[model samples]
Structures are given as structure tokens and as C-alpha cells.
Target: MRVENLHCSKRINPLVNFLIVALILSPSLTIILIPISFLLIMVYNVIRFKLLEPSVTRDTHEKFLQFIGGEPYYMDLDTYGKKGGTYADAVAIDAHNLYVLHEDNAVEIPWSMVRSWTIQAPGADRVVGVGMTAAMTAASHNIEAAAKAHEASGLFVFVADVNHPKWQFRTADTTILRKWNEILTQRNEGLLAA
Candidate 1:
């Protein structure tokens, strides 16, 4: 798929632009107009995102199918953190290779080249608390740490390639990460046995 076809341009609401112009001319109504402007922008953004989601998903699936001919054993569209001007990203597993669709291109990594894979939770040092009893502090810190980990967990795939040794796909949904990890482990074990 051509990368140029995936570029999307979002047009700002003309009413919002008009409202901003009004606010600039009528400075007396700044207090009332500011909140209304903010709310309208928020609503517009939510609606726009909801409408675009399905098309984005469909395009990602089509891209995957075009790139990987056979039916994928496992496919996930929620993967992220690949940043080479790609519109969407997904990870798929087949019998012989692991496929990553990103940057409007598909990359196939043979099972043998996958050295290791793991679901890495965010570090505990991300959250810090202050001015409490040691036990309370510890408890709060642990709770915050767990929450952060759950929110920012990612799957790390270590490949044998020298230039691109590690691939990280970040997602808040740990279930998918765990599932990928299990599938990869099984594939590695099977490769070893063969």
C-alpha cells in the first residue's frame, strides 16, 4: 500500500474559527465564550475520532492481508510505538514468521531469528510519593506503580538483526501482550525441537 494514500488531513470546524474571531472582537464575553469554545472543540474531536476509527482499522487489516498472503494465526491491531510516519501498525503471527506491519511496509521475521520476547511493564520509578509514613508511602507507591505499569505496558521483541535488534510495541492492554508472549515462546520451543 502506498504511504501517501494513508495520510489524513483533519479540517477544523468553521464555526469554531468563527467563534474565535468573535471572541477576539468582543473581549467582554471572554469568560463565557472560552468554556463554550473548549467544550465544542472537545466534542468535535471525540466525534471525529469515533467516525475515523473504523476506516483506520479496516485499512490496517487490508494492509496486513496484502502484505501477508496466508491467513494469520494471531493478529493484533492495537500495537503502537513504531514511528516511521506510519498511519497504522499491527503484529501478526504465522507458522514460520512473525510479521509487523508498519510504515506502510510489511516486515517478516523468521521464527528462528527471534531471540527473545517479553511483556515489559513500565518502571516503578515513574511514580513517586512524598510526606507519608513509610508503610503508607510504600503502599501508595506500589499502587501507583501497578497502575502505571498496567497503563504503559509494551511487548519487546528481540531479534538477531544487528541494526534493528529490538522492536517495541506499546499497548495498555496487557492481555494481548501476554498472548503474543505465549505464542512466541511456543514457536521458539518448537523451532528448538525441530
Candidate 2:
């Protein structure tokens, strides 16, 4: 006599089943998942870092740095030619305000007080800035974006001094961003790996 079939289909985990369903329903789920995963990893890493290296990032002041966002950053009156000068202990954001804390102050800047930033000397002395006027001036002077003038249209600087123009800043395309997402993805992986 012939034997009857007895094998059953393999079981799948409910957790995985839900994920499949959701992914199928919304392809964008993958996009959302990546950042969320990275954020979670970052949070975990930060917590781990705090535990492992307390001195490296003690409080927000020691760990936090000021960097600008966006592309084609402007050079302004407050931040122009602030480089090649002394470093500043107190970084002035505008005419009335200054940021000197290795930590953030409780008082929030109202945006009106902002003026510009500065750069400092190599030994971390002196001060300078990249003001709006400076950016406009740079642009107007060359008939090109400041980024192109210094071959830095992709980046912006924030000076450590009002007189000097070495302001703190970030670039639209840092060395890592040149290759686009591939570079960034690799960078993110590297950061996580570190």
C-alpha cells in the first residue's frame, strides 16, 4: 500500500509575518526603517559611549559642536575673512549674544540677536566670523557663490572670532558626500562601526 503524505508546511514567525505584510502594503516602509534603525543604533551607541568614555562627552557642552545645515552656505559681514586670526573663548552669534559654554545655555537665542560667527588662530587663539554681508560680498565680488570662490560652495565656515572669519560650519558635501548616498551610507556604517 502507498504511504499517505504526512509532511506539513514550515511555520513562519508571527513577528516576521507582520513585517512582510507591512512591507508589502507600504514599500516606503524600507525607507522609514533604515533611519529608524540608524537612530536606534545611534542612541545605543551614545549611551554606550557615555558609559565607556565618560570624559570624552561629559555633558552636552563637551560633546556638542555647532555646525550649519544646507547647501551653498552664505558668507556674511559677521563671518567674512575671520580666519588666520586668534581663537575666541566666546563665540558671538550676533551683536547682542555670545555662546561660550562648552555646554548649552538655558536661555534660547531669539534669532534676532544673531549676527555671525568667527574663526581662530591655529593655537586656538584669536577670532573671526562668516557674516551674511561677507557672503554677499564674496558672491558679489566674484559674481559667483562664495562656495565657488574658495572652491567651497559646498561648505560654510563659522568663525571663532568676530574679527577673524574662521567660524564653525559644515559643508553641503563633505569629503564623504562627494559620491552621494554610497559614501554617506558607508560613512554611516563607519560611524556605527566606530
Candidate 3:
């Protein structure tokens, strides 16, 4: 399929958009706040790196397990897209559905709605590896630290369906997409018993 022909639309993260709007509406306060926030961020990064371990990626599943319950599922970083920018949005997946939580609303999509899917990873991801346990598994064999670092890199997930328009989402890494596909697509046509 002609991906080059497809538009690489920019994804404006909604929370960022809201904050920008709020700041614009209050320019006097924004000017004052921006400098303070920048200083704080710079200080935090400096001190955190010097004195503390870097933060780990929160397991997207465990974070929202209260909202979704099932064994052995896939929870992508909630960034949905096969290409383009990937933001760390609140996205989760279970055995039979994909759950996306937004600022004012949530979306739950059945597996039936996903007719097909594709994963888009950059050259870097392929060099490190791009799926499931294998990615992590590869990490330990001399490339452990490098692979782990690569694991948090960006990738996109695309879903195509007859009933709905084609959609794309971003993921923090390719493993999320692979794991999601493995769990969500294991069973073919039968309805998930829920």
C-alpha cells in the first residue's frame, strides 16, 4: 500500500493543546509561569540524573488494570498510529478490546472493529528488534542496555476496518504493538467470552 502517498498528519496531543490554549488566554501569567517551569524542569533533570535513577516506564496495563481485567493481554502505551508522532497517551488493550482514555471521554473498540493492522518502526527499531519478549530477550545477549534504551523509542500502530475509518496511533515502542497483536489477535472469528 502506498505509504508515501499517505499524508503524515501531525498529531497534536490534546493535553498539550489545552495547556497551550490556557496559557495563551492568560499571556501575562504565561510569561511568568514559563520561566519558572523551565527552570524547575532543568533543575529536576539535572539533580535527578546526578543523584537518582531515571524513572522507568510505567506499565500501561497495571496502571489501568482497575478499568480492564483479563489475563495475559496487551496494553500499548495508548499512542495509536502506524506512522507520525507518538505521544504517551493513555491507551490500554485487553483480550478483546482496545481502550483509550482521553481528557473528557474514553473509547473502547472491539476486536471486530479491527479488520487488519500494521506496525511502523524506524530503522533504529529494526536494528534493535521490534516485537514481544524477543526484543527484551535480545537485549540481554550483549546488547542488554542498548536494547532496553531502544525499547522506549517511538513507533506507530495502524488499524483498518470496514465499518470504521482507518486510524493510526502511536506507541512508546514496537513491543507494545507486537504484544497487543499477539494477545488481541490470537483467536480469529469467535466472540470473546466476556
Which candidate ranks first by TM-score, i.e. highest?
A: 1
> Candidate 2 on 17-101: residue-level lDDT in tens?
4554455466566654644544453464345434433332232222122321111111111112112111111121322222222
Candidate 3 structure, TM-score to reference = 0.37
Q: After superposition, how far is residue 1 of candidate 1 from its true place, in Å?
A: 18
- lDDT per residue for candidate 1 within 133-167, as digits (tens), equals 44445655675675466445667778888777776
Clashes of 3: 13
- Candidate 2, 86: how far from true, in Å? 23
Provide TM-scores for the models.
0.62, 0.17, 0.37
lDDT of each: 0.61, 0.29, 0.43
Worst 10 residues of 2 by lDDT: 1-10
Worst 10 residues of 1 by lDDT: 1-10
Better of 1 and 3 by lDDT: 1
Mark the regions of model 3 whose C-alpha exceeds 4 Å error after superposition: 1-72, 78-87, 101-105, 124-164, 189-194
> Number of clashing residue pairs in every model?
0, 56, 13
Model 3: lDDT of residue 99: 60
Off by over 4 Å in 2: 1-58, 61-100, 103-107, 124-194
| Per-residue accuracy of model 3 over 1-194 as CA lDDT, tens digit each | 11111121224356654565565466577545754544453454345333321111233334344455554344544422212222234455566676653321234567566556555544332235466445444443434343344444332234454443444444446676676555445544444343
